[model samples]
Target: MELQTITIKREDYVSIVEINHPPANTLSSQTITELREAFQILKDDIDTHAIIVTGAGRFFVAGADIKEFTEAFGDYDAAFAMAEAGQALCDEIEQMKKPVIAAINGAALGGGLELSMACHLRLAAEDAVLGLPELNLGLIPAFGGTQRLRKLVDMPTALEMILSSKQVKGKEAAEIGLVQAAVKGDELMDTALTLANSLVAGKSMTSVKRALECVVQGADEALEHGLERERVKFAELFLTDDAKEGITAFVEKRKPDFKHQ
Candidate 1:
């Protein structure tokens, strides 16, 4: 589907959603709305098993459109609403059934960093720079960055990054657990696609989705309860035809052909 602020290209079952705002690819209110719509389309696409999100040109996303905040000026309520809406978008991405990977091709600051945190995994180009620099504007990361950042790194590291507004290169970001890995700029998409395909290969979509749910929800629950839930999910997969085929193939030393059943 055509969109005003984003472009979607598909290769097999992986859909690549690129943020198309020129220059820095800043996320304005309208762009956010477009992103919401784009993601909804992907969510409904049965053939799309995984998604890679990136930006065109030299940026992944610099941040939210500063113009919106400047125009709002002192309207605290409007600003708060904007924060809530952006956070909701991040929440939607985090809760998506299919895996969403952030391919950071360049700078990802403030809201951009928050956006990356929302993805199931993040892969960045070697030259990419990431940070939460909203402090320079006398603001903070309002799009779940405060929470998600802590989850990715230690409390001290998260506090340092968010409060200091420090930018780190892609390799350093990966070293600190901000990204899964750093790849050469030219190989970013190829690396992202490879990871996306690996996630869905020879696996039942039902099990994959269930496992994601367990991991996401388990973070908030007690360990014993979470283990019990995982056990239940494991047992449930036994009833799936995909599981049967996988087990049979394993015993026969042959590759399994998963039907996503």
Candidate 2:
């Protein structure tokens, strides 16, 4: 499919998706729609075992397009609809079955940070900076940032960052658990692809989906409920051919060939 706001390229088992809006890579409503469409195609592609989301030029995503924001949010209902759409997009990313990694190459501010937070994993260039600076615009992050950031870090740190509109560099973000790792700017995509390749190497897509579901969904539920779901998934996977092969291979002392059955 042709997409104006983003570009997609396939490499090995990974879909390299780059947010392609020029210098800033702002997320206008149309950009969000394109993102949803792009992901839909990626999700349906059987060969796409993992995905890496990055940005073109200098910014991962600067923020929402203020021009689009002012135009769409001319009234209360429009504002509500816009916020709902943005939040729903983030939620979709959070729940996506295929592993999605955000390679933050530069600034990931406001909605950009929200999008990165939704990914299953994040790897940042050492020079990258991330934050939710919506307060500076007299607004709060409407794309699940308040919730996801809280889940990712301590409440105190979340509050301090959000309230102060503070931005942190990649290394500090990794140290605080916001990103999985930090690499040099030139090596960011390579590092992300390496991580993606590792995940796809010997893992069943079904197992990957269920495992992600357990963590992402469980994060929103009570501890007991989450544990119950995890137990159910654990027992259920044993019935799959992949699981059986895994066990047989372990017993035989050979590498398992998983067909994602």
Candidate 3:
């Protein structure tokens, strides 16, 4: 399928979605809408077990297309649509059945960083920069930042990043848990693939999806729903070859070759 604003490719069970708007990859309302549609297509795709999002040129995504905010010039609908696009992208990525990983190669600021946070895992290039700079524009992140930021890191850290609007290096982002790890700029996608493929090798689609749901529902939900969810998922997986292979492989001291059943 052709996407108007982005490029999409599926390599076996791993799908790579790239932002090719060029320059700084500032996301506009149209681009956001297209990204939502692209992700929707990926969600419906059974062949793809994971989705990795990145960007072309020198940026993952610099931020929202500030032109929209300025052009809004007090038009509430403009503001509404801009925020709607950002929020929709975040929500869609979060609830996506297949795990989504953001491979940040360069700058990811404002909504760009929020986009990264919505992913189940994030891998950034060592030279990449990330921050929430909406404050400088006299605005705040409207794309689940206030909520998801605190969830990813601590409140104090999230607040410090948001309130202070200071950009941080990839290693610091990883150290603070904003991202899972930092690799060389050229090694960003390689690291992401290593992790994604490892998950594909260990679990079926059902178990993977359920695990993501459990975590996204948060720690409070984990305490209340985790065990029950895990029990149900485990029982379901038992009927699949994946479970047998997994158990037999463990007892055999060999690798479990998952079938994603």
Candidate 4:
């Protein structure tokens, strides 16, 4: 399928996903639908071991395409559906089996930051800024921002960012655990791909996926529960073709060619 708002490319074990609804790349309803479909396609493809999500140009995504909502929001249900559908798009990335890395190369505000937060890991560029500035617009983050933000960072930090409508730099994002690494602008995609390659070659990607799932799905839970959750996934991995190939390669002390299946 052809997409004007997103670009998809796959080479070897990685898939590069880019949001390209240009001029700030606002998330229009159409863009939301397209994004959901794009994510579904990539997530269903077993050959795609990892995905690197980034924007086409400068900004990752400003937020919801307010211009599209200005007139349609005359009804409350209309507004709710818009937010809910968008949230589902982001939610799919979290549920996907493979790893997803967010290459935050520029501004990632409101829904944009929410999108990045959905990824398994985030790497921000030095110039990247992320925040939930929805309150300033007389609205709060309606697209999983309120929940996901707090889920990612501490409650206090999430509230501080939300209430103040403040934008945080890459350094601040990394320090607060919102992002794992911060690097030069040009290195954002490269860093993400490098991380993806490392996971692809480690012969423990199923373990990595298990760990990510345990933490992301654990909720306000205890370590024992989290460990148990991970244990289940780890055991389940042994049922897949990836487990057979990866474990055999490890026993042979050779590189595993993961099909991500």
- At residue 223, what lDDT does model 2 achieve? 100
Candidate 4 residue spans exceeding 4 A from truth? 202-212, 220-228, 238-261
Better of 2 and 3 by TM-score: 2
What ranking of all candidate models by lDDT puts the best one first?
1, 2, 3, 4
User: Where in model 3 is the C-alpha error above 4 Å?
Assistant: 218-222, 238-259
Give lDDT tens digits, candidate 4, residues 1-261: 567898899868799989999899888887888888888898667677788888988998888887867766568988888788878988888877788889998999988998888888899998888999889878889888888888788999999999999899999899999999999998778788989888766555666667667877786578888878878887898898888998899899998886655
lDDT scores in order = 0.92, 0.92, 0.86, 0.84
Please identify which of the two predictions, 1 or 3, would achieve the higher lDDT against the true structure. 1
Model 3 deviation from the true structure expressed as Cα RMSD, one decimal place: 2.3
**Which lDDT tens digits does candidate 1 get at residues 60-100?**
99999998898777788998989998998899898888999
- Candidate 2, poorest ten consecutive residues by summed lDDT: 65-74
**Which portions of model 2 show Cα errors greater than 4 Å?**
72-74
Kindly give the stretch of ten consecutive residues in candidate 4 with the minimal lDDT sum.
200-209
Comparing 1 with 4 on lDDT, the higher-scoring candidate is 1
User: Per-residue alpha-carbon lDDT of model 2 for 1-261, expressed as tens digits?
Assistant: 579988999998999989999869998988898898888998889999999999999999999888866765558888888788888888888889889999999999999999999999999999999999999988899988999899899999999999999999999999999999999999998899999999887888879889988988998799999999999999999999999998999999999999987
The parts of candidate 1 lying over 4 Å away from their true place are none
Instruction: Give candidate 4's error at residue 85 in angstroms.
Output: 0.8
Clash count list over all predictions = 0, 0, 0, 0
